[model samples]
Target: MDGRPSFLIGGGQAADAIARIDWAATPLGPIGQWPQSLKTALSMMLLSSFPKAIAWGRELTTFHNDAFAPILGDKPQALGRPFSEVWVEVWPEIQPMVEKAFAGEATFIENFKLTIDRHGYPEEAYFTFCYSPIRAENGEVGGMMDTVMETTETVLAQRQLAVTNAELSHRMRNALAMVGAIATMSLRHATGLDEARRQLSQRLAALGRTQSFLSGEAAEDAHIYELIEQSFSAHPNLRQRIDVVGADFRLGSNQALALSLALNELITNSIKYGALSKPEGRIGIRWDCAGFRFVWREAGISGVEAPSREGFGSKVLMQFVPASFSGQARMRYESDGLIYELEAPAAAIDNT
Candidate 1:
């Protein structure tokens, strides 16, 4: 061995350590005497980045770092153990899967849920795993390989978003119903036939605007202040007598329409019997959302009482509104004026 090291330069301890070393008994002596290229190729194949394992015959198997160890759980009696012994709990299910993979075929599982006592504790895990046959020199399947990826987070997020959206839709529908009722009722009590027709037209126009905003057909979201202003815009005489106080917030189509109609009725009622009836009377409107409840209340109507008959506006507000959006509305007669309130969930406000 001259001055050079006794070990071959290219076949040093470090190089051998990095390569896949197999000690299986083959027909041609031990497997180590296979051609140098064949041995190197096999080493590279096993040591590749892919999570890989070779399941030999019906029991024993070996796998690489990126694949085997991470999924082994806490069984110290795992490596070199029979496949059935290592995965006893799932062997019933894994048996058929492994058999199919070894029959020279590949199988894929998408979005599969699995629970196991992998680390000595039971936990649910979701994984997409695949089984493929590992081929021999003559292209015959000699063993099987396994591969996987996790999708638990993505699945959970999607479910949560869906639930929230459904809640929102229900709320929005109720709000729209409330608005429609108010508009219709207000038109019913106009001073004369001509006045009633004119009020109906105006209310219809306001309803259209509310609908457009909630449906996203409008370029901008419907701000509560803007909606209040629009509702009052139709009544210049009562405009100065009204005050709207609240932080600006957006409403979906259903919510916008509900508020729009409700405001229309409140303002109209004030004009006919509340503060608008008295030159010095003033109407105050306020609203906000807390704990998922949307609250709207109006004050400053004087000596009000529930009408003996159900008017067009009352029907729309009482029946249509609640059924449409799944919400409730109440009107109370106070000496100073009328107070009306609506309550529902935030989801009714998300048109999206």
Candidate 2:
């Protein structure tokens, strides 16, 4: 009765709009008049244009905006009905969340998955939402406000990436098997223990090279010319004694290391027990490829037999070569000298 005409003033207009006035049929009368400022602010906030809604009476009422109606198709019709009555099917799953929110506790969930049957079509969705307690005039928890966002696409994409990585690993292992087979066939006929051991060591070195390459490792390849140059560098007098005649072939990182070691062992053995040990002896190293197969031979060992039992050098040479490159080593003894032979798949020997 102050006759201030609260509705006529700017602040009074807001209070009047915020005041509760039931839209659905209810047992209680219209909510007592509220200040105009409070009413105006609340009227705008509850304009039914958002996707989330406020629930009163323990989520029994839908203070929903138009934005939330489509997602809850028929629920809007039961505005003042008990939540359990309207969404009884989902009650068990949603009950705990509602209880926590109503008990004045804030709860948050992320990427929460759920399946909803919409118009007979089941749709899966991921949701992130928070339930916050809403307070009443007496400062007591009255209901809850729900805010949510959808994130279905991002979750599915990550699952797909995991599957792709597994497939890649399988293919890589299969390709390695093929390479191993070629290395074994390459050194199948080395004429003597010394010759066979040298070829075997090379193949093993090649295998090590492949492993390194797979892990993105790199190093210089061993060139036949370079090996010869290094060998002769140690003995300027022997430089003319050894004959290396062949077109230099480029080797892949894998081939380079293994072949280099094999050549090194051969040279060392020749110096100690082969033709190089005799001032009048000569050594010849040569190679040729036919179709998909490569052959390499080392001749001139002063017609002497290398040890049969093998030493550390022999073990390393034999085990590494064929095993590394998937090839084989062969040894033969001739009245003339020793012959070490190597034969392998073209693919394994091809530098390209």
Candidate 3:
């Protein structure tokens, strides 16, 4: 080591470390013997806040600033090591870029993915950076300088947003298809334009309400009672005449939508001609866990008889709604009233 003080003209920890380094013991011999191009690049890197590194000579010995230290993570001894040895994990991916720079061709890459072991554990990362060649006094390529910035967080956020957008688009398409099916079936059972329009509007409104419920934070599953209550909210007067009793079970979004629409149809029919047609009329709904059995019984209407033909409402209760959950449904008209029963597997209501 020389007795004269090393002249380091920068204000950072990296600059101070450079001043104290035993350059005589390294491959480059001593700081006084360093080429002008290497000295100038090292000065700029030590003074800047950005992460930068220099790989000089045939050995590609590494020299980096304090700002680049954290990027090396657990490998603190990498400061004076060869670039290839320090970053061996990603050497294969970056070798081509380094070769291009050595050939006097500068290169830039954005959001380049690399699997690195900076934290002792291997993990994927992203970076945007440029590699430029440095020339010696004789005009020969002597080394490469790299200015790099990590972009892992930004890249991951963009990927997550894309997935969320795709899911929302798929849900919208399914909802629109369900609305079309409801409109077609309702119109088929109507005797007049006015009746058809009324049925279609009511069914769509019920569908909209269910969709709104699922849009909330706890959207994955909803209680069976909450779904049934939402169907009757618009007809507050009929709520008093309906009795719902069962152990509350959670249903997935699709199951909730189908069941809500079925309940709306049942209530609408009762209001028009069944138990709800009379002041004293009432409907009882009950369910149990065994096979997910559900029963709906109506009482207090006179002259009750099974319809000679099936209507949209009857089909919804006896066919469509139950089929949505892979279940079976049965309907009967006794001398006194109407009865509907359904049985479904628990998995059918909860699985996607």
Per-residue lDDT of model 1, residues 147-236, tens digit only = 766666776777888986785666457546644654556565666778777777766776765665555543334777777777777777
- Model 3, span 71-136: residue lDDT tens: 777875765678999999899989899989999999999999999998879999999999999998
For model 2, the local distance difference test gives 0.55
Q: Could you give candidate 2's per-residue lDDT for residues 1-352 as a string of tens digits?
A: 4343333233232233323335334632344443333233334435534456556654355444445556665433544556565556566877799889888899899988877544455577676778777777676776667766666677777677676566446535643563454345434456666866665565455444444443343233445465446434545777676666667766554555455555555656666777667777676666664422223333444457757755434543566655555667665555544556555665676366
TM-scores, one per candidate: 0.51, 0.40, 0.80
The global Cα lDDT (0 to 1) of model 1 is: 0.60
Candidate 1 stretches greater than 4 Å from native: 1-50, 67-81, 137-140, 157-264, 271-273, 276-312, 320-335, 339-352
Model 3's number of clashes is 0
Point to the candidate with the largest lDDT: 3
Least well predicted 10-residue stretch by lDDT in candidate 3:
2-11
Off by over 4 Å in 2: 1-24, 27-50, 73-81, 168-352
Q: Whose TM-score is greatest here? A: 3
